[model samples]
Target chain A: MGKVFHEIRDPIHTFIRLDNDEKVVISSRQFQRLRCIHQLALTFLVYPGASHKRFEHSLGVMELAGRVFDVVTHPHHLSPEIRELFSQLDTDEKRSYWKKVLRMAALFHDVGHLPFSHAAEKELLPDEWTHEKITKHHILSDEMQEIWSNMTPPLRAADIAKLAVGPKEAPELEFDDWSTILSEIITSGAFGVDRMDYLLRDSHHIGVAYGRFDHYRLIDTLRILQAPPLDSKGEQSREPTLGVEAGGLQSAEALLLARYFMFSQVYFHPVRRIYDIHLKDFLCAMLQGGKFPTDVEGHLSFTDNEILVELRRACSDNSLSTSELAGRIIKRQHFKRLYERKPTDFQKNEQAALLIKQALEDKYGAENIRFDSPFQKGESIDFPVQLKDGSIESASSLSKTLNEIPVVKTEYVFIKRELEKEASLWLSNNKDDIIMS
Target chain B: MERNNQRTILLGMIKSLKDNKSWCGETHIQKAMYSLKTITNTPIDYDFILYKHGAFSYDLRDELTEMRADGFLSIEINPSPYGPSLAISESGQRLYDKYRENVSQYDPNIDFIATNLGAKGVTELERISTALYVCKKDNIFDIEECASRINELKRHVTIDLARSAASDAYKMLQEYEKHSC
Candidate 1:
C-alpha cells in the first residue's frame, strides 16, 4: 500500500503528519483556498515578517491538537473518576476514531476565511453570519461531505463542525459530554490547542517572544478533572472539566501571561489595529452591496491575493471610487491615533474612547475618523487544577500569577493622517472634558 | 430583551433562587435561566448548550462577569478551595428596585424554576436538566428512549440514573405544561 501518512514541515510544530484521508481533504479546493488568506489580517503591514498564511497555522493547530489528544487520552493521563465517567477513553476503537476526527476538525477550522481573514469579517458578512458559520457551510458542501463519507467510519460533518467552531460559535449544533470535551481541547478558553498554536506560530513568524509558553509541560499536565463548586451547598459535586495538574500551574500561568502580552503588544498594536480599520473601509466600498457573498463558491472566489491586486490597481489608477481607501493599505497612509483609552477617563465614562470618538467625529467630520477596540468580552482564564492528593480547585485561588493576570482591552480612535498633529493637540487639551461630558 | 429587563430578571432570579434555599452560584442562575427561557418560553433569548455536565450559556456567564465589572453584582468570596458565589450589591439592589415593575411579569417563571431547581447541586441539576433538554430539543417524550438518548449524550451516567433523570424531567415537563404561562 502507498504510504498513508504525509509530513509537512512547520516552524512551530517541526513536522506535522497527516493520514491519507486528511491528505485528500488538504488537497481539496476548499482547503487549498486558505493558503491565500492572511492569518493576522493586515498585521504584516506593521510587522513585515508576519506575512504567514492561515494554511500553515491550521496545520500547526492540527499538529498540536493531535499531541493534546494523545496526552489527555493516554491511560496514565486518565484519572480513575474520569476513566469511569468516559468509557470511550478505555475503548481503543472509540478513542482512535475521535482522535482522527479531532485532527481533521482542527485542519478544517479556518477554511472559511474571507479575503483578508478577520480584518473585515464582522462588517463584510451578512447579519448573523460569521466565519465560523461559513466554515460550517464549507464542511457541509458536497465535495467535502464526500471526503467525510469515504472515511473509515464515515466522519459526520456536523461532528467536525461542532469541534471546529465549538459551542459558542456554532450554537445550532448540540454537543454531548464527550463532544464538549473534544471541543474544549480545541477551543477551550483556558488551554485549547487552537490558541496554543496561533500564539506559538504567530510569535515565531512575527519574531516576538510574548506568545511563547511551555507547551510541553502544559500538555503533559492536562487532565480531565472535576472543578470545585462555587459554594458549600454543592461542595462534593464538582463538574469535570479540562484542567492541569498542580505541577503544571506555572506553565498555565505562563500561557495566560503570554496571551496578555501578545494582545497588548502585538495583536492590538495601534498601527496594526488601524490597518484593519482601513482594510474594512476598503472592502466595504469594494465588495458588492457592502457585503461578501455567503454562498460557498462566491465566498471562496477571492482571497488576499485578489484583494492585493485590486489594491494595487486602485493605488495606481485614480478612477476607482475606493482609490483613497486602497491607498491607505498600499501606500501605508493609514489613520493616525487621535485618542487612546485611559483608565482615568474610563473612571469618568466606561465608554471613554467612544465618547471621544463621537465628539471628534462632530469636529473633524464623521468621514475622517474611525473607532476600534480589541475583544473586551468576558474571556475568563480560570480553570480547575488538580492537586497531588486528588483534590481539584480553581486555579485563581491557588496560583497568584493566574489570579493577577488582567484581561487585555485596547480602545483607539484614529484620525486621517493629515489631521493627526492638530487632532492630537486638541484632544490632549480637551481630553478630560470629552470623557466627563 | 432589553439590558435593564435582563438585569431585572437576573437579579430577581438570583434573589428568588436564594429565597428558595439554592446556593445561587452562577450555575444556579445558568440552569434556572435555561429553565426560564426554554421551559417558560419567555422572550429572554440565550444560546445554551449541553456543556460540562449540564446546560451552560457563555453569554450568561459573561453577563455575570460584566455585571460584576459594572458593580451590579459582586463576588461574595469564601474560604480556600471553595469557589465564590455572586450577590447583588447595593447598586444592583437599587436598580432592581427601580425596575421592579418591569420584571414583575416574570415572577411566576422565576418562582417555578427556583422552586424546582434551586436547591439542587450541579450534578443533579446537570442530569435532570440534560434529560429535560433532550426531551424538549429532540421531542423525545418516552422515558426509556429519553434515558437511552441521555446515556448517549452523557456516558458517565449509568442507565439507572439516566432512567430516573428522564422520569423526573418528564414529570416536571408535565407539571410545567399544566401551569405554564
Candidate 2:
C-alpha cells in the first residue's frame, strides 16, 4: 500500500496532516500529554470559550511551519544571493529531509510548557531553567531518542531541540547554516510560526477580532535574504534570514497590532489576571513539597486536568491552603480591584504608585493586597523587510504605523473582595497622593 | 531614582560614550557601566552578576532592546571576527541632552571609564571585566588573588593572561580611586 497520510480536523487551520513519522511523534506518550494542558491557562476562567489545549495548537504550528518552509525555500521565491546558496540543497531528497525537521521542531516547541502555561513558571522552576530548557530536556531524553531511531531517515534530536529553543537559550549547541535558517522559520524574532499560530488560534477560541490578521498573505510573502556585513574588511558571507516581501508589510503590521491588542484587551484583562494570580497561589500551596515534576514520567503525571482534580480534592479537605485559593477560583469569588494605575499615570508617578502599594499592603495584610505590574512594554516587532528593489530594511523602519503604536503597561492593586469597601474608602482619600507626581 | 529614570541615565552614559567616539559592542558598554557603578557609587541598579562573559545583566540587555526600539540606539552586526557594535542615534543624543543635568553626578566616572576602556578590543575588555567581577564578588583586592580567581572562573585563561587582566583591573581601580579623591 502507498504511504497513508492522516488528517486531523482543526478549527483554526482547517485541517492538519500528519505523515507516518509525524504520527509516531503525535502518538508518543509525551506528545499526548499536551491534550490535558491548556493553551492559555486560566484564561478560560475569564473567556469561557478559550478552553483550547496545546495539542491542537502544536498541530497548527506544525502545519503553518510546513507551509512557511515551502514558501521560503522554494527555488523561484529566493533572492539571487540566497538562491545561489539554496542551490546546494537542490535535490528533492535534501529538501524533504529539512521539511521534516522544521515540521517536527514546530510540533514539539511547546511540549515543555508547565500545567498552567507560564503562570507558575517563575514560582516553580529555577531561575535559569525556563520552559524552553525543559522542552530541550524532553526532546533529547531516551524516549525521544527511541522515537527518532524508528524514523526512516532518523532525525537528529539536537537539531529539533535547537529549533524548539533559540540559539540564545541553548548557546552550547552549534547548528549548521541550513539548520539555523530552518530554526529561524520556527522561532525567529521576526517570522516565527509559534506566535503566528497562537495569535490566530487564541483569537478564534476567545471569540475576539483583535487577534485576526492576514497570516495567509504574510506567509505567502515570506522570502529569504542576506543582510550586509557591518565590517568593511569582513567577508560578505552574511547568513540568510527569513524576510517578507514588500507587499506583506501591511499584513505584518496587522499581525503585530493584533498581538498588542490581544495582550491589552484579552490576555491582560483584569479578571483573567486575578484568576491567574489565584491559580498560581493554589499551585504554590499544593506543590510546596517539591511535587512539581521534572522528569518526563513525572511531568506526564500532572496536567491541567490533574491540577483541577487536585484542587477539587483540596477544596473538599478545607485544611489545605489550596482550599481557600482554589475555592475562590472554583466559586468565582475573585479578588476585587481596589486601585489601578493606567499606563500614562504609572509612567509619570511611579514612586507615588509604589507608596500607594506600600500603604495598602501595610493596612491590609500583605497577602490580601496583591500588586500586579505585568511587564507589557517593548514587544519586539523588528523584522527584515525585502523591498520591491530587493533591498532589506527593518520592518520598524519601513512602516510608520508600527512605530506609532506604544507598548501598554498596566498596574493594578487587588484587595480581597470582602475588604473591598474598606480598600475603596482608603483609596478615595489617598487618590491625590497616588496620582500626583 | 526609578527604573525609567535609571534608563535615562544609562542612555545618557551611552550617548556620552558615543559623543567621545569610543562606543563599542554590548560587552564593552556593560563593563563600562559596571566600572562606573563601582567607582562613583552611581544609583543605577542593574544587579549584575558573574555570567558567561563577565558582570552580565539580563535587565540591562532588556533595557538596550527597549532603547533600540525607541530609536535611541542601534546594533550593527559585523562579520564573523568582529562583534555587533552599539551606536547611539540622533534622537538618542537629543534624549541624552534632555536628561544631561540629572546624570551630571556620574559625568566624571563615565568619562574616565569610557575613555580608558573604550578603545580596548573585545578580548581585553572581557578579561578586565571578568577580573574586576571576581575581585568584587570574592572581596579580593590583592592582584594575585584576583588573578587566581579569574583563572578559576574562566577555565581557558592561562595564569599569565589572568595576571595581566588582574594587573589591568587593579590599575583601573587605583586610577578610579585617585580620580574620586
Q: What's the DockQ for every one of the candidates?
A: 0.38, 0.09
Write one digit per residue (lDDT tens) for candidate 2, span B1-181. Answer: 7665676678766766666665365666787788777756787877676543456665676677666645567765444323356777776666666567776777777788777876665456667888887777678888888888876655445578779988998898888788878
Clashing pairs in 2: none
Q: Candidate 2 DockQ category?
A: incorrect
In candidate 2, position B76 carries an lDDT of 57
Per-residue lDDT of candidate 2, residues A30-133 (tens digit)? 78999989999989888988999999999999999999988988878876666655543688887887788789989999888889787858777656777888
After TM-score superposition, the amount by which residue A163's alpha carbon in candidate 2 deviates from its true location, in angstroms, is 0.5
**Candidate 2 chain A weakest ten by summed lDDT:** A228-237
How do the predictions measure up, each by TM-score? 0.88, 0.77
Which candidate achieves the best lDDT against the true structure?
1
- Please report the interface RMSD of model 2 to 1 decimal: 9.3
Per-prediction CA RMSD (Å) = 3.4, 7.6
> In model 2, what is the error at residue B12, expressed in angstroms?
3.3
TM-score of chain A of each: 0.97, 0.93
